[model samples]
Target: MPRLPAPLTLPPGHDAAGATGPDPAAARDRYRALRRRRRTETATAWAFVAPSVAVIVGLAILPVIWSLLLSFQADDLVTPSRWVGLDNYRALRQDPHFSQAVGNTLKYTAMYVPLSMLLGLGLALALNRKVRFVGLYRTLFFVPFVISATAQGVLFSFILDPQFGAANSVLHHLGISQQGFLTDPGQALLVLVAISLWSGTGFCMVVYLAALQDVPASLIEAARLDGAGRRHLLRHVVLPTLAPVNVFLLVWQLIESLQVFDLVYVTTKGGPLGSTTVVVYFVWQQAFQNFTAGYGAASAYVLAVALFVIAAGARALRRRDAGSPEGAAR
Candidate 1:
C-alpha cells in the first residue's frame, strides 16, 4: 500500500479547518451578514402579509367578536343596549320557532347532502370517460351554478307554479294530476331540496371530476390486470384514493346545507306555514325583519359553535380513517 501524505499544520492564530472555512473574524462577519439577511427576509414577508391580515381582522374577526358580545346583551338595533347575559341563549331553548327551524335545517341537510353527492359522483363518473361533446355537457351542467340564487328561484318558481306552469302542463299532457309542489306544505321543503341539488351538483361534479382525473392510470390498469371489474376497481382503488376529497365534500356540503338561505329567502320566505324555515333564514328574520338583534346574534353564535363541533369531528374521523389499515393498503 502507498503511504498517505502527512497532515498539514496551520501557523499560530490560524485554524486548520478547510479552504472553504474563513478566519474567525471573517466568519463572524459572514454570520452577522446572514443574520441581517434573515431579518430582512422575515420583515419583507410580514410586510407582504400585513394588508391581508389587517383586512381579515377588521372584516371577519372583529364582527365575530362583536357578535359574541352582542349575544350576551339585549338590543333591537335601536335604543340603549342592555346587558342580559345568557338570557338570549336561555330563550333559544324555549322558543318553538327556533326548535322548528333547527328540525327543518337537519331535514334539509339529510336530504341534500346524500343526493348531491350521489348525483355529482354519478355525473363525474359518466363524464370522466373519453366521450364526445364532453366539454359541451360540462359547460351546460355548470351553467346553473353560475346563475344567481335569486334568478334560479325566479325560474324554478315559474316551473313549479301550480297554474299555467310548464311542469304542470307536461303533467297534464301525460294525464297525471297536477301536483302543488311549492304551494303544498308537505311537498315544499322537498321541492326546495331538489332545487338546491340541481343548482349545486354541478360544482360538486366538477370537484369530483378533478379528483377522479388525479387517480393514477397505472394503478387502475394494474387493478384491471388482476381481474378487477368496474365495481371492484371503484371499491378498492377509486373510492379509497378519493377518500380525502370525499371527506372535504361531505363537510363542505353539510355546512352549505346548514347555511341555506338565498334559495329559501327568494322562493318560500319561510313559507306557507313556516314549514321550510331553516336556521339561517330564521336568524335573518329575527335580526332584520323582527328587529331582535341580540337574540339573533345568540342564535347565530349557537349555530357557529355547532358548525365548529361538526367540522372538528369530521376532521378527527378523517385523521382516524387515514391511519387505518385499509387506508394504508390503499
Candidate 2:
C-alpha cells in the first residue's frame, strides 16, 4: 500500500459517459439513410401498381367517359358524330316500355335477393357440420355456380318446354296441368327469378359457411350449455355474426338482378309481350337491335344512377348500424 493508486484516466477519443448521448453526426447519417430506404420502398410500390393502374384507366375509365359522351350525342354505332344534348334522357322517360322495364327490374330484385339469401342461409345452417360425404355434397351444391349462365338458360328452356319436357311431364304425373314456365307473361319473370336464386344461392351459402366457421366455438358451447336450440343460437349468435355477409349478398343480388339480360335473351328473347324485359334487356334492344345507341347509353346511365342510389342507401344503413352499440359489440 505504499504507492497511491494512479487516478483512473479515460482515453482522449472516448466519452466519459457511457451510452448516455447520441452522436449527432451518426444520427443524421442514419436518418438520411432511413429516408432514402423509405423513398426506395415507395418507388418500388408504385412500380408494382403502375401496370394495374394503367390497365384500369385504359379499359374502365376510358370506356365510361366515351359512353358518357355518346349518351349526349345522337349516334348510332355506325355514326357517332352528332350531338343531341338531353333529348335521349327525355325520350327515355316518355317511353312506356322503359317504364315497364324499370318496374320489372325492381320486381326481379325484390323477389330474387331475399329468396336467395334465405335459401343460402338455410342451406348453410343445415350443412355447417362434419357429416358423411360432406365434401361431395359441397361440390354438388357448388357445381351450378360454375356453369355458364347461357348454358343454364338453354337447359332451363328445354326443361320448361310445354311439349315433351321433363318438368311438365312430372307435373302431369302429379295431377297438375302443364304450365307455361317461360311463355306465360305472368310466370316468365318468376321462373327466371327462381332459376337465378337456384344458381346464386350456392355462392351465398359458401360465403355463409366461411363466415360460420369464424364464429366462436366458445360462444356456441356456452349457448348449448344454456339449453339454446338451433333457432335460439341462430337468432342470437349466427345471424348477428352474418349480418355483414347478408348485406353484401343483398346489395350484390340487387345489382345483378337489375343487370339481368343473358338469361332472358337466351331463354325467352323478352317475348310473351315483353314481360321478361328488364331495363338492361331493353337497353340492349335499343342499342344493338334498333340502332338507338345514344338512347340506350342514356338509359344505361340512368340505371347506373339508380344502382348508385341503392348502393349508397345500403351503405348508409350499414354505417348507421355499425355506429350503434349492438354493432360495435359484435
Candidate 3:
C-alpha cells in the first residue's frame, strides 16, 4: 500500500487486441508461419507419393494411353504401324470371328454373372448359421478363389478332359458316354462357364457372407414374429438389406466375366472352333497369336468401354440410391 501506480485498464478483449485488433505485424507473422507449415506438409506428402505416382503412370496410365492410340493404327508387331483412323474398328464390325467373339463374350457374361451370384448367395445363406466346422466349410469354398488362374485352368482341364479326365472316367463307370466337355465347340463354352462358376462363386459367397454379417438380426426376428416364413424373411428383410452389396457384386462380376481369359487360354485356347473366344481371349488371339495387333487393340478398347459404362452406371445408381429416402432410413 505504498502508493503503487494504478493498473491500466482496456475494454473487455481490448487488452489482448488493442482497441482495433491484434497487432498487424503479429498477425502477418502468424499467417506466414501457418502458410510455411502447410507448404512443408504438402511437399512432404508429395515426396512420399511421387514414386507411387510415377509407377502408376509408367505402368498403368501410359499403357492405357498407348493402347488407345494403338487401336486406331494397324500394327502386326512385325511391321511398322500405320494410322488407319477407324479402319480397325470398322473391320471389327464385318469380321466374323470378332462378331463371334463378342457374341461369345456376351453369352459368357449372361450365363456367368447370374448363375455365379445365385449359387454364391445360396451357399452364403447355408453357411450363415451356427454349425460345426462352419469355418472349415467356408475355407474349403474360398480355396478355389485363392487358387491362381493358371492352377485353376490346369486343375479343371485335367478334371474335364474328354479323354483321360476323372470326369470322363466317372462317366465311363456310370456307363454314360464320355462327354466332349472342353473339346467340343458346342459344349466348350458351357463347360467354361461351369468352371468359372466353380471358381468365381467362392468370391461371391465370401462377399455375401460378409454382407450377411451386417444384416440386422432384429429385422429378421421382427419379420419372423409377424408371420414371415423363410422365403418371405429373405425377400422382404434380408434382400432389401443386401441391395447395395448386390449392386457391387453385379458390377464387379460383370467386369470380370467380360475380361475372362486365363482359363480360356490354358484350357480352350479359343476352342476346337471359336467357341470360348471371349473378348479378352479374342484380344490376345488377335494381337499375339493372329498378329492383328490393331484389331486386338480395338477389341480391347471395346471391352474397356463396356466395363467403363457398367461401372459408371452402377456408381450412378448407387449415388441415386444413397440419396433416396430408403437409403437414409437404413
Candidate 4:
C-alpha cells in the first residue's frame, strides 16, 4: 500500500528567531487561553467541594440543630411530639439520674485520665531509651490498644468475677481476700475506670513516644551540662516541651472517658444500682432501651454543648500556659 503524504511542517521563520520564545500576539492569546482554562479548573474544583460541604451540613450539622430543638420539646417515645419549651432542660436539672450520671462520668474522668497519662508517659520514657527488645516491649504494650473495647470488657468481666475470677484467685494466692470488682455498687465504677486506664495507656504511650523523639537532644544535653538531673529535666525541659501533646492527650482522654459506654455496658450493664452508668450510657439507654428518642437527643445535645465549652476552656488555658521555645528548651 502507498504511504500517505507527510503532513506539512511549519518553516523555521514561522515563529520568532530572538531570545523571546513566541510571537507577542500569539503569546498573549496563549496566556488568555491558559487563564480561561485555569478559571474553568477552579470552578470545577469548587463544584466538587460543594458536594462535600452539603454532605457535612446534612449529616452532621442539620442533625445537631434538630436535636437541639427536640431537646426543648415534650416528645415521648409513644406520644406525638409537641414543643414544651425548655421542659427537657428543666427536667434534666431536676433529674437525679442525670446528676448521678454526670457525677459518675466525672469520677471516671478523675480516675482514668491521670492514671492513664502518667502510666503512658512512664512507659514511653522507658521504651524511648535504647534498651534490648524495645520494639517487642512497645508491641506488647500496644496490643491491648488494638483489642476492641467490647472484647476487653468481656475478658475482664470473666477476670473480675467475684467468686471464681482469675484476679481473685491470684489475690487469694497472695494471701489477699476476694473483692467485689464489677459487682459492688461502690467499687464497680472504679473497676471500669481501671480497665480503661489499662487499655488506653498504651495508645497514649505511643503519642508520648512520638513527642519525646521530637524533643531536641541538644536541649537535653544543655540541661545535663547545667547539672539538671533526669527529674529536673523532665519537669523543667521535657514536660514543658510536651505540654501541647499532653493537652491533646488530656482532652481526648477526657472526652473518651466521659463517653465510655461499650465497656461499661458489656461488663456491668450499668448495674449494681446504676453505679457505673455514664452519660453516654444514659443516652444509649434512653434511645434504645427506653425507646425515648427525643430524650436521647436532648441528652446528646446537652453533652455536646458541655464538650464544646470544656474544649474551648482547655484550649484557652493551654494557649495561656504555653511558653516560648526558648523558655521550654531552657
Candidate 5:
C-alpha cells in the first residue's frame, strides 16, 4: 500500500483546526447573526398574526375579563356601575329563580347528554354497517342538524302546539288526549329536552360515525378470531380505540346542554311557571329583561367556572387513559 499522507495540521482559528477554537470575533459575529435571524423570524410571525391576536384580545379575552369584573359591580346599562363585592353571588344563593334555573340546567344536562350519546351511538353503529342507502340515511339523519337552531325551534313549536299541531293531531287519532307540552309547567322542560335531542343527535351521530370508521378493522377481526363476541369486541377493541372521541363528545355535549337557550327562548320562554328557565335563559332574563347586568354576570361566571372544571376533569381523565396500557395497546 502507498504510504498515507501525514495527517494535515492546521493553525488555531483556521478552517481545519480540530482541537483548537475558532476566532472569537468570528464566532461572536455568527452568534449575533443567528440571534438577529431568530428575532426577525419571531417579529415577522407576530406581525403576521397581530390582527388575529388583537381581535381575540378585544372581543374574547377582554370581554371575559370585563365580565368577571362586572360580576362584582352593579350595572343596569343606563346607569353608572357601583361596586358590590360578592353581593351578586350572595343574592344568587337566596334567589329562588336562580336556584330553579340551576336545577333545571342540571336536569337538562343529565337527561340530554346520556340520551344523545346513546341515540347517536346507536345510529352510528347501524349506519356503519354495509346497509343499503347508507349515504341517504346519513343525510336524512344529519338534516336536522343542518337546519339552524332558530328554524328547528320554530318548527318544533308548531309541531308540539297543543291544538292544530301534527303531534297532537296524531295523538288525537290514537285516542290519546291532547297534551299541553310547552304550556304545562310539569312537561315543558321534558319537551325541551326531547326537542334538543331531536335537533342535536344528528351532529353527535356524525361524530360517532367518523370515529367508528377510523377504528381498525384488523383489531376487530383479531378479537373475533380469539372467540370474542360482538359485545366483547366493542367493549375491548372499539370503545378503547374511540375513547378520546367519546370523551370529547361527552364534554362537548355537556357544555352545549348546559348553555341551552335558543329552543327555550323560542318555545317556552322560561315557561308557565319558570319550568324551563335554564341558567343561560336566566342570565338573559336578568341582564336584558330585568336590567341586572351584574347579577347576570355573576351567574355567568358561576357557569363558566363549573364548565371549566368539568372540561378540565375530562381532559385529565383522557390524558390518564391515553397513558394506560390499554390505550397504549390500541
Candidate 6:
C-alpha cells in the first residue's frame, strides 16, 4: 500500500482531545426546552383528566364514602339521620332474611360461575375449528349477551308461566303434569339461574374464543408432535395458556352472580316465598321498599368487603403463579 494520509486536526471545541465538545450554553438551553415541553404536556394531561376525575369522585367515590358513613346511621330518605354506630351491622347479623339472602347469593354463585364457564368453554372449543359460517355462528351465539338482563327475565317469565305458557304446554303434550316453573318457590331460583346462564354464557364464550385465538399454534403442534392427545394437549397447553382469562371470567361471573338483581326484579320480584331473593335484591328491598337506608347501606358494605377480598385473592393468585416454578419453566 502507498503512504497513508495524515490524520485531520481538530479545528475547535476540543481540549487536547480529538472528540468534538458540545457548547455548554446550547446544551443548557436544550435541557431547559425539554423540561418546559414536559411540563406543558403534563399540565395538558391533567387538564384532560380533571373532568373524568371529578365525575368519578362525585358519582362513584363520594357515593361509596357516603354509603360507608350511612351504614353507621339511621336514616330514611325523607328524615334527618341519627348516628347509631354498629347497630345496623349488629341487626344485619341477627336478621334471618339477611342470612337467607347471603346463603342464596353464595348458592347462586357456586352454581352459576362454574356451569357458565364450562358451557362457554365448550362452545368456544367447538367454534374454534375450521367450519363454514363461523362468523354467523359466533354472532348468533353472542346475540343473547347483548340483550338486557331485564329483557331476558321478561322473555323467560312469559315462556315459563304456569298457565298457558310454552314450557307448560310442552310438558302437557309430553303427558307430564304441568309444572309451576317460575311460580313454584322450589323451582323459581333454578329457573332464574337457567335464564341467566342463557344470557351470560354468550359473554363467557366470546371471551374464551378470544383467548383461544391467542393460544400458540407452535406449542400446540409441538405437543401433538410429542405424541400428546387432544385431552393431554388441552390439559398441558391450552388451559394453561388461558389461565389469566379463566381467572378473569371466574371473578367476573362471581361478582355478577352475587349482585344479580335485574332478573330477580323483573321475574319473581323476590317472591315465591323469597326463594329467589339474592343479596342485591334484598338490599334494594331494605333501602327502597322498607326505607331502611342505613340497614341497606350496611348490607351493601358487607358485599363490598366480600368483593374486595375476592379481588385481592385473585391478584395474589396471579402473583403467586408468576413466581411459581412451573411459570419459570414455561
**What are the clash counts of all predictions, listed in order?**
0, 0, 0, 0, 0, 0
- 21-106, model 6: which lDDT tens digit per residue? 88899899999999999999999999999999999999999999999999999999888999999999999999999998998888
Put down candidate 5 lDDT per residue, 1-330, tens digits, no spaces: 899999877876766536666588988999999999999999999999999999999999999999999999999989999999999999999999999999999999999999999999999999999988999999998998878778888998899889878999999999999899999999998988898888789999999999999988787888889999988888878877777888899999999999998888988899889999999999999999999999999999999999999989998998898798977776
In angstroms, give how far residue 63 of model 4 lies from its true place: 1.9
lDDT string for model 1 (265-325, tens) is 9889998799999999999999999999999999999899989998999989987986999
Give Cα-based local distance difference scores for all models: 0.92, 0.89, 0.91, 0.87, 0.91, 0.92
TM-score of each: 0.85, 0.84, 0.91, 0.83, 0.87, 0.87
TM-score-better candidate, 3 vs 6: 3
Root-mean-square deviation of Cα positions for candidate 2 versus the true structure, in angstroms: 3.7
TM-score of model number 4? 0.83
lDDT of 3 by residue, 17-111 (tens): 46655677878999999999999999999999999999999999999999999999989999899999999899889999988999999999999
Two-way TM-score contest, 1 vs 2, winner? 1
The window of 10 residues in a row where model 4 has the poorest summed lDDT is 12-21
Q: Lowest lDDT 10-mer window, candidate 2?
A: 11-20
lDDT per residue as tens, model 4, 1-330: 999999866654364433434578778999999999999999999899999999999999998888788777766667788887767677778888888898999998999999999999999999999899999999999899989999999999999999988999999999998899999998999888888877899999999999999999999999999999989999998998887788899999988887788998899988889898889999988878887677777888788888988799887876666565553543
Error of 5 at 94 (Å): 0.8
Which scores better on lDDT, 1 or 4? 1
